[model samples]
Target chain A: MEMTGLFFYLVSVLIAGGIYAVLCLALNVQWGMGGLFNAGIAGFFAVGAYASAIVTTAASDKHLGGFGLPIPLGLAAAMIVAGVTGWVVAKICVRLKSDYLAMASVGIAEILRLVIVNESWLTNGSLGISGVPRPFADLVQGRSADLVYLAVVWFCVLLVYILCQRLYVSPWGRTLRAIRDNEDSARAAGKDVDWFRLQTFVIGCALMGLAGGLSAHYFKFLSPSATEPLLVTFLVWVMLMAGGSGNNRGAIVGALAIWFIWSATEIFTSRLPPEWITRSSYIRMLLVGLLLQFVLQKFRSGLMPEKSPKIRSD
Target chain B: MIDFINLYLVPGLAIGSVYALGAVGISMIFGILRFAHFAHGDLMTIGGYGVLTAVWFIPVNPLLLLPFGIALAIVSALLVDQFFYKPLRKLPTIYTVIASFGVALIFRSVAQLFWSSGNQVFTSGVRMPMVLFDTFRISELHMQVIILTVIIAIALHFFLTRSKLGRAMRAVSDEPELAAVAGLDTERVVRWTWVIGASLAATAGVFAGMDTSMHPNLGWNLLLAMFAAAVLGGIGKPMGAIAGGFIIGIAEETVTYTWFSDEAFISPSYKSAVAFFIMVALLLFRPQGLFKGRLL
Candidate 1:
C-alpha cells in the first residue's frame, strides 16, 4: 500500500478503535461500576446508529428521515433514543437477578437487531440505508475527511473519559460501588438500588449510542449487518473484560490494542498462501476465544484494576 | 380451522419435542452448575456429527442408530466434562461461562476445520413416513422424536422422583452445601447430572439431525430457542424447560400460519429472533418463569 493509503487505513482503524473504546467505557460503567451484566450493548448501539442515520439523511418518498438536522443534533437525538431504550430495558430487567438479567438483555438485543432487519418499511430492511453525510464534511476535503473525523471522535472520547473520571471519584461513584458490592446492604442503608442501576445503565447505553452514531456518520452507512451479535456484542465484551472492566483508561487501551491486532491480522492474512489464509480466519477466532478464556483465568482483575478513590477522614 | 390445526399443530408438537429434549439438558446443567454453558449447543452438534459418523461406518438401520448415537453422545459429554468442566470446577461461575464460550468456539473451529462448513445429510433406507389414520400423516423422523422424548421424560421423572441417586441429585441442586454436610456425595451427583443432561442433549441433536439437515452451526443456531425455553420454564426446573421448549416451538410454527406472507418477507432467518422475543417478554413479565416460584 502507498504511504498515504496506509496512513488513511491506520487513521481509520484508530478512529474505529476510539469509537469502540467509547463503547467499552460505557459498558464498564454498567458492568464494572454498577455490576449490571448487560449483554445487549449492541442493541442500543444499533439503535443510535439508525436513529442518527434516519434523522439526518434526507427524507424521500421511499423512506423517512428527520428534516436534515445538523450532525450534532442528530447525534443528540441518537443518544436520547438509546438512553430511553436502555432505561426501559433496565426498568423491566434490573428487577431480576444477575443471570436472568443477562439473558433478558441479550434477548432484547437480538430482538432489536431483528426489528432493524425485518422492519423494512421503517429501517429500509436488510437493503440498508446509505448516503449519510459526515459531520463537517463540507469543510474537510477528500482525503482529509478521515483525519478530521478521527479528530472529532477522539475529541468526544476525551470529553467522555474526563466526565467518567470525575464520576468515578464522586459520591455517586461511592454509592455505585456500594450497590455493586452488596445491593441488599445498599438498599438497607437507604440507597435506591434500582434507580441507581437504572441511571448507570441508561447513561452507559447513551454513551454507547453516541459512539454508534459517531461511527455511522464516519462510515456514512447503516446496515443490520453492522450489529451482528458476534461481531458487535461479544467483541465489545472481549474488549471490556480484556481491558480491566472497572478502569476507564484500561477500556480505551484495550480497545485500541484489540483493534490494532484485529486489523493487522486481517491485513496480514491476505498476503499468505490461499489455503493458509483461509485457515487463518478460523485460527484468529479461536485465538480470540482462547485469549478471553486465558485472561479470565489468569488476570480476573483485568489488565488495569481501577484504583480505589482515596479517603481522608475529616 | 380444524384442518389447519391438524396440519400444523400436530407437526408442531413433534418438532417441539425435539426442542424440549435439548432445553431439558440446558436447564439441568444451569441448575447444577450455575452458569450458562455455551458449549452445550456445540456438544449437541458433536452428537449429531457422532451419529452421522457412526451411520457412515456401520450402514445400520436408523432405529438401531438411536442407541448407538445416545451412547456416543454420552461418551462425548463425559469427555467434554473431563477435559473442560473438571478443571474449571474451582473457578467462579462467570469464569466457567466464559470458558464454555471458548470451548464452544474451539469446537466450532474444529468442526469447520475437520468437516468443512457445508451441510451434510445422512439418509438411510428407512424413508417411510408414519401415518396416523388416513387423514393425518407424519414423518418417521417425527415419530421417532415423539417416542424418544416421551421415553426420556418418563425415565428422567422416575429417576428424579423414585430413585436414591436422583433424590441425592435433587438435594444437591436445592442446597449444595447442605447436601454436602448431609453426607450426600455432591461431586457424584454433579457428574451424573452432566451425564444425563449431555446424553439427552445429544439425543435431541441426533433426532433433529434426522428431521432436518445437519450442519456445523445447527446446534448454535438452535441455542437461542433452547435458552428461551429453559428460561421460560424456570431455569432449574427440567420439566419446566421441556414445557417451555414445546411452547416456544409450537408458537413459532403457529406464527407462520397467522402471518405466512409477512413472515416470508421477514425471512425465517429471523426465526431465532422469535425465540429471543419470547424470552425477553417472559423476562419482563415473569422472570421466575411459569412453573418456578421465585428466582434462585
Candidate 2:
C-alpha cells in the first residue's frame, strides 16, 4: 500500500482504538475496581448507539424517535438510558455472586439485541438507522474528518483518564476496592457494600454508553449487527484483562494496542488469497484465544498489574 | 387442540430434552468442580461437529453413530480440563471462568476453521410424520430424540445411584475434602464427572443438530438458556436438570403464544427471553430452585 494510504489506515485504526479505549476504561471501573463481571457490555453499547441515533437523526416514517436533537444531548440521553438499564439489572442480579451476574448480563445483552432486531417501530429492525449527523461535520470534510474525530475521541479519552485517575486515588475509589477485596469486612466497617456496588455498576455502564454514542456519531450510522457478542462484548474484556485492568493508563494503551492487532490481523488475513481466508480467519481467532490463555498463564496479574490501592488524596 | 399439541407441546418436549442434556453438564461441572465452565456450550458444539466429522468418514447412520461422538467429546473434555482448568485448579474458581471464556472462543474458531459456518444435516431424506395420539403428529427424528433422552436419563440416574464410580462421584461432590480423607480418589471422580458430563452434552448437541440444523452458533446460542435450566433445577442436582429443562422449554414455547394469537410485546424472537426471565425470577424468589439444590 502507498504511504498515504498506510497513514490513513493508521489514523483510522487510532480512531477505532479510541472508542475501544473508552470501553476498556468503563470495564476497568466495573470489573477492576468493583469486581463486577458484566458480560453484556455490547448490549449497553447498542443501546447507546441507537438511543443517540434516534435522538439526532432525521425523523423517519418507518421508525420512531427522530427529534434532530443536538449531539451532546443525544450522548447524555444515551448515558441515562444505559445507566438506568444497568441499575435495573444490578438491582435484580448484583445480589447474586459473580457467575450469576455474568449470566444475567449476557441474558440482558441478548434481550437488547432481540429488541433492536424485532421491534421495528423503533430501531428500523435489521436495515438499521442511518444519516446520523457527525459533530462538527461541515467544518472538516475529507481525510481531515477522520483526523478531527480522532482528536475528539482522544480528548474524551484524556478527560476520562484524568477523571478516573482522580477517582482511583479518592476515598470513594478506595472503598470500592476494599469492598471488592472482602465484602464482609467492608460491611463490618459500615460500608454499604451492595449500594456501593450498584452505584459503581451504573456509573460504569454510563461510561460505556458514552463510548457507544461516540462510536455511533463517528460512524454516522447505527446497526443491530454491531452489537455482536464476539465483536464488542468479549473483545472489551480481553482488552481490559490483557492491558492491566486496575491501571487507567494500562486500559488506554491496551485498547489501542489490541485494537491494532485485532483490526490489522483481520485486514491482513482477509487479503490473503481466497484459499486462505476461510481457514486463516478461524485460525486467527484460535490464536487470539490461545494468546489470551498464554497471557493469563504467564502474566497472571496482567501487563500493568493493579497499583496497590493507597488510601490518600490524589 | 391437536395442532397446539403438535406445534408446541411436542416441540417443547424435544427442545427440553436437548436443554436437559446440556443442563446436566452445566450442573455437574458447576456443582462438583465449583466453576461456571463457560466453555461447556462450545464443547456441545464441538461434539456435534465431532460426530458430523466421524459420521462423514465412517458412513454410519447419525442416530446409531452417537457413541463415536460421545467418545470424541470425552477426549476433548479431558484435554480442555488438562490444558485450561488444571493449571488454575488451585486458584480461585473465578479464574477458570475467564480461561473457559477463552476456551469457548478457541473451540468455536476451531470448529469454524475445520467445518466452516455451514448449516449441515446428518442425512438428506426427510423423516415422515407419524401418528402419535390419534391426531397429533410426530416425526421419526423427533421420536428418536425423546426416546434417546429417556434412555440417557435413566442410565444417568442408575449410574449416579447404583454404580460404584457414580456413588464415588456423588460422595466427592458432596464433600471433596471429607471424601478424600475417607479414601476416595477425588481425581478419579472428577475425571468421571467431566466424562459423563461431556458425553451427555455431545449427545445432546449431535441430536439437536439432527433435529434442527448444525451451525457454529447452535450451542453458543443455547448456552444461556441451558444454564437457566441447570440453575432452575438446582446446580448440583442432575435430576433437576431434567425438570428445569422441560420447564424452560415449555415456557419458551408458551411465551410466543400471545404474539401468535394477538399482537403482543413478546414476539417469537423473544423466546430466549422467557428462560432468562424465569431463571431470574427463580433466583430472586427461590435461589435453591424447586428441588433442594444448593444455591452455589
Candidate 3:
C-alpha cells in the first residue's frame, strides 16, 4: 500500500510538472525568443483557468456557467480568451523597456485579481468554481483516472515542445532573435519590431492559458488561490530559467526537476514537529528563492543551454 | 464637504504620503541602478516588521521606534544588492530584475517565518479622531503622517540641490557614463541611494502599518500604487514622484467618494484599479512621464 501511494504521488507530480513544462515553453517564446518580459503569467493563467472552468462545469446558480461544454472546447476557449487579454496588454505595454513592462504587467495581474474577487456574479467571488470536469472521466475509474490525466498532460507538453522547437529554428524565430538581440538594427533592417513582439506575447500567453486549463481539469476545481503569482508566475519562471530559457528540451527537464524539488520538499516539511509545521512552508519558500539565486549565479545559461542552428554561408 | 474632507481626503493624503516615500526610493533606484527593484515592496514589509519588533521589546509607540525599522530595511537592501545584484551588474539589467523577484520571495518568506502570516497591530485599540471646529474630524496619525512627509520632501529637495553627494547622485542617474567620466565616485552614490531609498521605504512601511494593521503583504499590496506614483512623477525624478504619489493618493480616495448620488461613483474595492488606470494612460500617452525624467 505504501508503495502504491508513492507511485500515485509520483504520478501527481508528473502531472503538475507537465503543466509547468507547458507554461515554461510559453514563457520561453516571449522572454527567450522575443525578449519580452511578461511578469503577469498568473493573470493570463487565471483567465484561462476560470474561462475553462466556467465553460465546462455543469449548470449552477453559484457562478455564471451553464454551458457544460466539451473539455477540449473549454481548453480552446481558454487559450483564445487569454490570447485576447495578451493582445490588449501588449498593445499598451509592449513598447516599454523590460523593467517598465514588468511593473505594468504586475499591475494588470493585480487588477485581474480584484476583478475575480469583487465580481461575484461572474466568478462566484472567493468561493471559486467546483466540479470542473476532467477529460475522459467516464472512461476511467479511481486510480486509473489520474494516470489518464497524466498521459493527457504529458501529451500536451510534448505537443508544445515540438511546436517551440520548430519555431526556434524557423526564419520567423530568427527575426524575433534579431529584434531581441538588437532592436534598432532589426528596425533598421525594416522589420516591424512592435508587431512581432505583440504576436509573440499573444502566443506565449495562449500557451499559458492552455496550461492553466489543464490544471483546472486535472484538479477538477478552480479557485483564485490556485492561481497565485508565487505558484503560477514565479515558479514557472524559475523552471524556465533553470531549464535553459532558449531550449525547449531544457524547459521540460527544468519543469520536471524543479517540480520534483518543490513537491518533495513538502514531504519533509510536513514531517517536522507540530510547532515547526506552520513555519516549514515559509522555509521551503526561502529555499526555493535561494535555489533561484544559485541557479542564476552559477548556471547562468541553465542546465540545457541553447544551441543556435548554423546556416550554410555557401 | 466636511464629511468628504474628513473621511476620504485625510485618509487619502496619509496613504499618499506613504506612497510618496516608497516611490521616491523606487524612482531613485530605477534612475541610478537601471533596473526595477522588484523586491522594493518587501523592503517596506521589512520596515514595518522592524518597527513592530522594536515595539514588542520596548512597548512604546511604533512611531518612536521608526529608526529601528529604517535601519533594518537599509541593511536588507544593502545586503541584497551586495549579494544578488552586485554579481549580476555586468550582465543585462533584466537579470537583476529577475533576481529581485526572487529576493522579493525570500524577503516575504523571511517575514512569514519571523512573524506569522496573521495580521498584527502596533497598538490594539483604535484612537479616537481629533475633532476640529466641531465639524472637521481627523486622526492624529493622519496629521502626523502629512506633516512628516512635508518635512521629508523639503529635506530631500535640499539634499538634491545643495549637497554634493545628492548632485552627484542626480548626475549618475541622468547620465551614468558622463558621471563616471567626470570622476564621480559611482559606488559611493550607489550606497547612498540604498541608504536614502531604504530609509524612506522603512518610514513609509511603519506609517502604513500605523494607519492600518501590519501584515506580511502590507507593502506588496501597495506596490503598484507606489509604482504608479513613481512613473506618474517621472521615472527618475524624485520630486515628480512625490507629486505623482499625492495625485494618485488623492484620486484613489476621492474616486470612491459618493459626490453626485447616494452611492459611490466607483466601488471602493476598485480603488486600487484607479492608480493602474492612471499608470496605463500615462504610459500610453506620456511615456516620458509628467516630469520628463527619463525617456525609458
- Which prediction has the highest lDDT against the true structure? 3
Rank by TM-score, highest first.
3, 2, 1
Q: Which stretches of candidate 1 lie over 4 Å from their true place?
A: B59-92, B124-129, B259-274
Candidate 3 stretches greater than 4 Å from native: none
Superposed on all Cα atoms, model 2 deviates from the true structure by an RMSD in Å of 1.9
Q: Report lDDT (Cα) of residue A152, candidate 2.
A: 88
Q: Find the 10 residues in a row with the least total lDDT in model 1 chain A.
A: A59-68
Report clash pairs, candidate 1. Answer: none
Which tens-of-lDDT digit does each residue in A227-289 have in candidate 2?
455657767877888899888888887787788888888888888899898898788778878
> Model 2: how many Å of interface RMSD?
1.1
Best by DockQ: 3
Q: Write the per-residue lDDT of candidate 3 for residues A156-219, one digit (tens) a residue.
A: 9988988998989998999999998899999999999999999999999999999989989998
TM-score of 1: 0.92
Arranged by lDDT, best first: 3, 2, 1
**Candidate 1 lDDT over residue span B50-146, tens digit each:** 7888888887655467666667667866776776677777864655665676677776766666666788877845576656766666676677677
The local distance difference test score of each candidate is 0.79, 0.85, 0.91
TM-score, one value per model: 0.92, 0.96, 0.98
lDDT of 1 by residue, A190-233 (tens): 99998898999999999988988998898888888765455566
The model with the greater lDDT, 1 or 3, is 3
**Chain A TM-score, prediction 3:** 0.97
